[model samples]
Target: MRITNRMLSNNAIRNINRNLENMARAQEQMSSGKRVNRPSDDPIVVARILAFKTSIAANDQYQKNMEDAKGWVDASESALGMATSTLQRARELAVYGANGTMPKESMQALGKEVDQLIDEMKQIANTSYGGRYLFGGSRTTEAPFVDNTGNDKNVKPVIYNGNEANLEWEIAPQVKITVNENGQQIFVDAIDTNTGNKIGIFDLLKKLSNALNSGDYSGVEDTLSQFDQAIDHILDIRASLGAMSNRLEMSLSRLGDTQISLTQTMSKLEDVDLAKATIEYKNYENVYLASLATSAKALQPSLIDYLS
Candidate 1:
């Protein structure tokens, strides 16, 4: 309790420095608009902030995956639709050619048109999206269907070069969607149970083309049932793909909502209340100025100051 000018002045300087430190913190909050500028500022809140950020990062990746899945599904649906349309044209040609009034030359012309339709179907089976084949299964880099028949043959054979493996994407935690279907699933799986043969677009087109050229009018009519089956198959698969698109759209909406919620939580945890910080800064500044004033009066011209 030995009150001396030196002791009083030292204590006042220390108090001023402490007050300045508090004011600096307030100023920093105002400038940065963050309450927890450093981890030491609020350890618990900082920990929560980090966790929220981590969740947001993971969700963002899923969001991107959902987008990619949507793209794949849309491409597949479009390609399947085209394939169905080609099959329809082939069916109409068969019906027209089946008319007995059609002569040999007419049948041959119909056969030529059927050939073009088969080629179109081949192109569809080997369709690519974003540099990858939509129906190539997991072997997206390679064309799934190939023309295997020799040039001498009037009717060509098509070969499947892809597997039945499905391509998938993870749109959420533990949630996956098949983004692609193998060529076999779309074009080679529709078997005609009566004849124990696949009625898929490729096989049926070849048979129909052969029948038209050979002047087999009944044969043309026979392929109609098979064509209907193939179209039905494509429609069923396309419906499934459309459902996937809707699901992906829902996932995107949920991701948008979740991102917004996470961002709001993070803001609450880390952002400074500007009004509160401003008030605190002003109060600390006043206290520091008052301390300086008191210190000046107490230390001014004390006789002990000159002696020391």
Candidate 2:
């Protein structure tokens, strides 16, 4: 076979360029600690990495929703607890005021305390967290209960201005959580079976105050049964809050497990195996060095050695 200098030089240049390209690719992989920097590196691996990244991002969002749901539930539970305590205290005062043996002065003094408790309960019902009403159901941006006349003295005369909508948060596929409680249902619209009228806790407190101020012990006795109803109302609200707290805790646990699984799957898809990557990188380095040495030798003139 006849070989020309033009052919030899062209082949040498081609081989050197190929070897340098491979060396550059290996160096990039090593420096970035990634086997696939671009889709052209490995189309199949790039696709898998993209899918894993998407899943990771979705899982992150779900986790954030879970955290927000937990916070809202926690704040609601605390407010409900305070409201429950206020109801219990009001019930005690109602019982004390119902006693005919108690003097009018004492009954009037108890009315003052009951009125104070009414104000306290209103405060709890209007509790806000992060500039959002905790007990306002879906109306997080607005106050749940506002005084009818918008005055401090009439604060006990609160109205349910918020709607009975449930704030929903998605924790996973097909899994959602109600992150709010309706104050109207919890505090207002409580039915008194004896009168067939909806008598709320605030109304009962107001009646008690009126009865004590009039020195009507019998009227206080008649409203005593309503106090029991109010107690039951508080219990029911607390139970509902407890159930929601439990659901939130369960969702948090499941979300954590899902996040862990997603992390593992993402790692498997995109993370580099250091031991295998190091071995492959070393092999590519050796090949690149060998190619460089061979090209040098091939390009050198050796007429004396060839003749000998």
Which model scores highest in TM-score? 1
Q: How do the residues 153-228 of candidate 2 rate in per-residue lDDT, one tens digit apiece?
A: 3324667778888888898877897778788877887647565868677777777787887789888888767777
TM-score of each: 0.93, 0.89
lDDT of 1: 0.87
Deviation of model 1 at 283, angstroms: 2.2
Candidate 2, after superposition: displacement of residue 271 in Å? 2.2
State in Å the error of residue 39, model 1: 0.6
Q: What does each candidate score in C-alpha RMSD? A: 2.0, 3.5
TM-score of candidate 2 to 2 decimals: 0.89
**Per-residue lDDT over 147-258 for candidate 1, one digit per residue giving the tens place of the 0 to 100 score:** 8766733444687889999787887789887788788878878646595755457778889989999999998888888888888889999999999899889889989999
What C-alpha lDDT do the candidate models reach, one value each?
0.87, 0.78
